[model samples]
Target chain A: MSALLLHALGIVLVTAAMTFVTRSAPFVLFGKKRGTPPIVLFLGTYLPPAILAMLVVYGLKDVRLLAYPYGLPELIGVATVVGLHVWKRNYLLSIFVGTAAYMVAVQWVFQGTL
Target chain B: MMKTVRAAFLTTLPVMTGYLAVGVAFGLLLQKSGYGVAWAALSSVLVYAGSMQFVLVGLLADGSGFVAVAMVTLFVNLRHFFYGLSFIDTFRAMGRRRPYMIFALTDETYSILCTAKPPEDVDGKAYFFWIALLDQSYWVAGSIAGSLAGSLIPFDMTGLGFAMTALFLVLLVEQWEAFRTHEPVFVGLASALGAVLVFGRGNLLLPALVTIVVVLLLMKKRLTREAYAPPTPPAPADGPEAGGAP
Candidate 1:
């Protein structure tokens, strides 16, 4: 329709195309062949945990440790999650409580200071 | 089909909560940036990557060039390359659905699929598809709601984004419990932390991933022995190892 809409569409298409490339790289590379290498299989087995751990870090990458709050909200939130998960072993409860705790910490406990 | 959908829904309940919050946030931001409901829906349906969608709002608002948009998307989503490696065989077995499965492999979907097992009666492929489909639906629905109600909803959502971090932490704990040896988990944490320190948070992921792959390769002999070792016995038929093995 309009120039802005067209431009936005272009941005969306480009972003989607690049994203698909990354997501499908492994499938395209290893999918055509019948048998995959043992090393690739090994990496597949072990890489999930590593990647999950990295994702956790990536999620918190924006936390400014040297600032006023000094990453306290995230630290407490993580502690809450780990403690609740280890103790109760409930997935939904751990995430809900941990996230709520982090919210309260950020929204009120550390409010203006951060 | 209904049974599989029901099971998938139950399994994705946690993600339902997480995605709706973040998706709505994305929608509100996009709406605030002058895009409307149609744009929000389009982005969620086409792009589907949560973090990247959030970044896209800023890029769209500033009218960034397509080259800039592509570069930013690649850098933001490069981590996804490793995600499909774990699922290559699993998705390959899904027949024609293989392409969509790969396309929908967001962080949340990838994590849940890694651990969540279908019920005894439901088909595994159907279960996987429903999970992916339902997760995306929640996102799309939330985006539309936020775009429409952007002006009406005035509540502060400052900390709601923490749900993602919480979800990841919970999954990490599950992964830690599932695997007998914790070396991979430790390797991930140490590598990421090292990369953060050395490369800073903004540019750490690529280096972190590289270190992790190299380190894992070096320890393959020992790690593989322990992973497939008969001493600890295998983790149940539906365990993480099941997907990796041919």
Candidate 2:
């Protein structure tokens, strides 16, 4: 088999394994009989927002502040997303407008520079 | 079972809207990255993680080592570790369907299950199973459609990837409105900022998540109790407890 295909297979397996491990950890460690420990409950209830916030940062990790564009496209794009979401309370509108704004900024306004 | 499935489908309608947009973006990006529809559909079937799949594209394009990719996958989906905690009992009772239920516990599915209430006469496990199955089907279908469109269209979709970010932000705002305590959000933001300063952008996520988990663990006493505390009941209008006529 080709190396690229091998890599793809490896990726699929590794990712699937990782997902299984993560999802089943609480179950494996605590088992079915034991009540979910307080700590686990605490983390379960609170971790969603924390992880969501981290994902936002992760999503923006590639934008370079030191570069010529200075992350303006990202900032404006996020602002559009936040503004539209808060106002219209429509997820589709917010994501569509935000993504379009970012695409326009990067493809046109910030086209010349990296 | 059909009624349960219908209700589950109804509950998953909102996620369908979100998943279609993001899943299409994933497909388009994957096609642009030089992968074909088979790879797109395969990943959606096997990995089934929207955010991590985006990261996976970058990793695959770079031809990164297996070890590095595996580590990144673990770190990216670390949050799924906790998603299953609350559902342990619910899923354990699912008999033959237990494994698939566990496998399909994506963030969106978890959210729907957390709030889902099967009609009184319906089987709860069946309802949960249908929700998960329907949600996964929507994602898989969206991704396949996206890949087909990406291959057919010649349009440049620069900046469209922000849909995932926008999705996360919208979910964050909704969580913020629902929860009384904002400590976890602050912990996440601060930890991420600190990680960025220490580890740089490319390597920030793992450390930031580690730090947030640690901080939350340390402050578990205060956070767990208040974060999900049920609202206090109102006083009776004409009782001694109320400042009204007795």
Candidate 3:
């Protein structure tokens, strides 16, 4: 209870500091300066996508070749989400359907063991 | 307007799943380490970096001093500094909410915002804003859920972490399907493989991230820009009298 508040305090402060550093450094230091090295600009521009793609791949590195030996439920759910994502290009829809599908498939078929 | 909202919401879906899974694990880790939900919620609201939050939990658990945490986190989040560079142009147009919007910027949010070139008829800034807001909201919700549900659920939430990986693959498929551009995908894979090869399992994120950035930077000139580069206007319809009058 009270402990939660204290813990949150540290978390909040750190979060704010990190956010401020990243978000404000450019505006503060540059102060609306015009010249940005093209290499820096280029790296900055593409870095987000590159970072995200890396994050995703890193996130999934643990997904097994087979769940429950076959791991069909998790595997199938992931496949379905990918399918929906490509078909609709809708992130929310795909996630919602994927989560629901994953949840449902795991519960009903695997008896929630997954 | 609705379309933009729809896109924002859609773009945030994966974010939501990733947040929930990661955020909950964070909550569990913190709680077991004697921290509380408040820390989880506030950090989610503030820091909002998925991997860093996990790292922070471990650091705190290790009882490292503040100076160590600060330095490590600074580097851990150093890439975010680069994220803002590209966003400068996009953020400037945001007007009043600029500061707050920038504060909420994360890799995932920035990725969504960066690719959004508002239709000629729409405001790109607004689209970026909504996307950022929506993504942050999903994060906030997940963080809160994780914090509040710390011990309420009995299942092993680590398995839930799979959601993040699964969601990433989904986004990858989505991007590849829509863009048909292999450059970004190739760079991402190369970086991941690079990290796996070099880092050898000691926090592959930093290496992979560096590889992606370095690779992308190296290849910037070769790739074409966005699809919305507004076609050049026809040369005054040839004045209807040049060579052959209408």
List per-candidate RMSD values in Å. Answer: 2.9, 7.4, 7.7
Could you give candidate 1's per-residue lDDT for residues B1-246 as a string of tens digits? 899899999888778888888888788889888999999999899999998998999999889999999999999899889888777767777888878989999999988887776888888888888899999999999899889885577787778778888888988888888777788899999999999999988787889998999999998877867355421211222333434432
List clash counts for every candidate, in order: 0, 0, 3
List clashing residue pairs in candidate 2: none
Candidates 1 onward: DockQ, in order: 0.65, 0.44, 0.36
Q: Look at candidate 1 and give me any clashing residue pairs.
A: none
- State which candidate, 2 or 3, has the greater DockQ: 2
Output the lDDT of residue B189, model 3: 72
Candidate 3's docking class is acceptable
TM-score of each prediction: 0.90, 0.72, 0.74
Q: Which stretch of 10 consecutive residues in model 3 chain B shows the poorest summed lDDT?
A: B237-246
Ranked by lDDT, top first: 1, 2, 3
Q: After superposition, how far is residue A6 of candidate 1 from its true place, in Å?
A: 1.7
Q: Name the regions of candidate 1 deviating beyond 4 angstroms.
A: B226-246
**Model 3 spans with C-alpha error above 4 angstroms:** A1-15, A23-31, A66-75, A101-114, B1-11, B116-123, B154-163, B177-180, B224-246
